[model samples]
Target chain A: MAIRKRKSFFDIINEYFGDVEELANQFEDMFMEKPSWSQKNCTMEPLKDVTVTPKEVIVTVDLPLAKEGTIEVKPLDSKTIEISAEMKRKIRFDDFGITHHKGEFQRFYCQTRIPVPVEMDKVKFNLKKGILEVHMPRKRGERIPIE
Target chain B: MSEITIIEKRNIAPDATMLFGFPDVGLVGVIAASHLIEELNLEEVAYVDSKLLPPLIVLHEGLPHSSLRVFANNNILLAVSEIPIAADIIYPIIQALIDWGKNKKAKMMISLSGIPIQERQDAKELKVFAAGSTPEMLKLAKEKGIDILGEGYMVGPQAVMLQKCANMKIPALTLLAQCFYNYPDPEAAAEVLKSLANITGVKVDIKALLEKGEEIRLKARDVMKRTQQELSGIKKAREYDIPLYVS
Candidate 1:
């Protein structure tokens, strides 16, 4: 006969802390309105959407003028990502019928904190039609021995 | 004070068809409206003024302009906004526009917008759908070979416009093209404009719109960002929900 053991107290504590940390991160991301970087000097933050599922977290970014080869996605930590992409050409404010702003932008930058812990080493990304999509698997819960 | 006020810049044709293009999914409406204004050489006819609007003014040619303005030619009036209308004010803003259109004895009102679709990037051809306030309008869309959206949750200004028009017995139709949910999609905008031509019997060259798709996407990023903020406030994701029909 095979016997199944219950989870240890240490495992329960670890999972409880992990879930609380994830919830706090999610609340912060949801409520924070300002971009992590400064907006001066014609710098722009690309619009992004993050969807967290049980298995993975998917992030989609709108990089309007970006070329596929110029995009860079890096994980700053287990819960944070940094994305930057250079535009194919500089876009001037005057090009859009605005003359008050006297500068142009050649790139988009953003740093966002993911609401859930993810496997940073296994992150995968693709840029298509000026949109960048990143998929990261959720970190597996640690296993503990049952006495 | 009224929640929204329309200030007329010039006398407009009373029987013209009115078109509305506000910021929404894919930024489709704004792009299509801008193209229509350029192609048809529509001139400013009126503008909306509201205290509820954010404290912002747009400058063009060294002249101050309302963030939300109306343009018109002999056959049509186009109402477009440079910024996304906040969710709290969408109801009043759309109400005021519909009331003004009704008072002007406009023949019909049409809203050009987009419906978000999953896997939009993989779509080779986008399809346009229509929802009408009346059966007569639905028949018109059918004759024009546009699919009818029988059931779905609609968000933003167009959703309010449709409801108000229905209540006022004004003929209105909303044309929605399938598009990416969170990206500026000029291709979807082009598709919506093509559908507009069929329904309104108005034609404009779309070659330029397609050629400058990337440029438009770039220029519209700021507005799209603001729109993304307002969309969250309005619970715009309800547009994707499956509705429970209480028949």
Candidate 2:
């Protein structure tokens, strides 16, 4: 075994500042527009099927871990609906034997533009097994007239 | 020359240099920080790449005496205020905070978070945790009745900030409260904020949270109704089967 001599104070300072500068460069790269995993606010799982009935357009959204409240639906047109929801929550890192505690998070303002004109006034919503369902009634005038 | 400005609202000297976490992770530290900034009348000292891909805003404030920079983004505002656990390192991101913190001569830093929990789902009692630079910090943690957990993986910006601070030899601690994993839990955030106010001696008005809670509650209920209806059609069907094994 050979004994290794300690580095000089100047060497340590140089190394420390050098690492800091490298960290600065790394920060620049991290802040850059990163693709493939950018979205951080809301996790959206688009429904498997958005069925349009003669009287109503049934829009289903896969929202697991969703609360019974916090969904907002706005109708843009006879064929378009905008959906927004928020889920505010807190998490203890301890009970889970965790070290970090992310505080006072209200997962709100998750928005989605739905393709289908639904009646805003008569809109219906439901939550089951972490899934969200929205029923938008079709506009009366949009229906085909039968003589 | 790096441009710097000083903000003198009051002579309020901050004991801990806080790395204000994102909006919705452990409990909404960033939002609380925003509220503090508003309350203290802090001024913007710098802007670091607010127009990056995801978009973030960095502001500087030397409160009463201490100088520190706060980095935030529109994404943080637009986000659901949840802890981001995306499996990306963003190591460079943490380094940036270090650089920013060092520029202000910050001796110690704190990161805030909210963890999801099943117990106390309805009740509110935020537990504080600490991960410091040395044994002295650990002693402080014991004095505060705060547990110092040795290990666990943390998510989002705070996680990165913690690593950076530790690596840079800056005393750092992460405070978090228990929260629901799968729902918008404003009450939980409120609890965490109250604890934070107590810890940092920052005054926080709960009026905004109450108002926001009502608005969000109504929306959550509506969404839950719709979700239930959609899932009603899904049912499980099982058939009895006999397995054949080869001799």
Candidate 3:
């Protein structure tokens, strides 16, 4: 007869946490689901990324073919910013050899949500080598004095 | 049945330089390989069949084609993968390709790829580095004035191919150009191609490639995202770590 040892307490706790992590990942995939572009908006969504550090939040967007003078970044709210840029030339599905889909996009558009609190007034941005980098200083709460 | 098989659609010439352009940082290999195919006018001679791959078939002009294929001309047999190969299947797939290439008596195998840099966008120029499967290959790269990637953790198909080729005593090399981690970089592709030309004397004009750079980036966005996910799964960032060499 084959015998199996019972799982220890730490093993049970690890397994439970693993399940929780998996569930969290599934939920994130579900909530983050959306098409990368919108034909109605006539805007192609450029790739963007966000990173948070102790001092600041840095957001970078890959804006290929973006005209230097036509780029704009506006704070929509405390935690959200809208970015848009006009491409040097309009792009069409036909440009990509797709005849079935008929649409032309002249701009890139997207909204990024900041995860942590940041100072909106102090936002600064620069465009270089076709990448737009936005820097915002993080907000730190006041320290409490202990008697 | 073998887990991975290379199916030839037509006769493949022996003694050819086998090149690999699997998806990696900045989609370097894919971009370079596409340009090579267009410039060299290479034809598809073979495709990879594997249960290890996902149930995905890329359609071109209403025709089904394997995501992984081998394009060839008189002197070059280029292996190109349209989709990123998952981490678990990388070893087997690369080993199979090495075995196939070896059987064909390939003179040398080279993998065109990229090394990610944090400040890639701001850099005015990109540099290409090389790693070799043998000492002679390293010496050859140096003779051509290419810098050697002396020691680092390279995670992906090219890394696997290099190790496998070394074990089987086949000459192999990997060329990595400095490039963006997340964005498709056609500029890096051009730099690596220049190195390829210098090393092998196989030249292709990069003017057309440079002209269509932005369009390539826009079209390559989805593939780059998928490749990034696969790269993360393979712990690709370990390549950036400075190793403690005991020897």
Best by lDDT: 3
Q: How well is each residue in B37-84 modelled by candidate 1, as lDDT tens digits? A: 999999999999888888889877677889999999989999999899
User: What lDDT does candidate 3 reach at residue B201?
Assistant: 84
Expressed as tens digits, the lDDT of each residue in A15-92 for candidate 3 is: 899779767755775467565678998998888888898999999999889998999889987878899999999898
The candidate maximizing DockQ is: 3
lDDT of 1 at B206: 90
Chain A: TM-score in each model? 0.69, 0.47, 0.75
Error of 3 at A99 (Å): 2.4
Error of 2 at B94 (Å): 1.8
Residues B1-247, candidate 2, lDDT per residue (tens digit)?
3232323232223333545544433234544454545445554443333221133222224222222344322111111112222233244445555565565556566666566553333343556566565577667666767667655545555666667777777776666666533344455556555655555455467667655554343334323333223222221000012334354
The worst-scoring run of ten residues by lDDT in candidate 1 chain B lies at B217-226
Model 1, A37-130: lDDT tens digits are 3436455687888889889999998887687788889998777899988877777767778665567777788877888889999999997777
Candidate 3 has an lDDT of 0.91
What stretches of model 2 exceed 4 Å from their correct place?
A1-147, B1-16, B23-27, B50-52, B55-89, B182-184, B206-208, B215-247
Tens digits of per-residue lDDT for model 3, B186-246: 9999999999999888899899999989889999988887888888999999989998888
Q: State the lDDT of candidate 2 residue by residue for A1-147, as single tens digits.
A: 999999999999998997797677567644653321112543332332366777787765544334567776676544456665554443222322434433233343333444555567898877644446677777666457799
**Inter-residue clash pairs, candidate 3:** none
Better of 1 and 2 by TM-score: 1
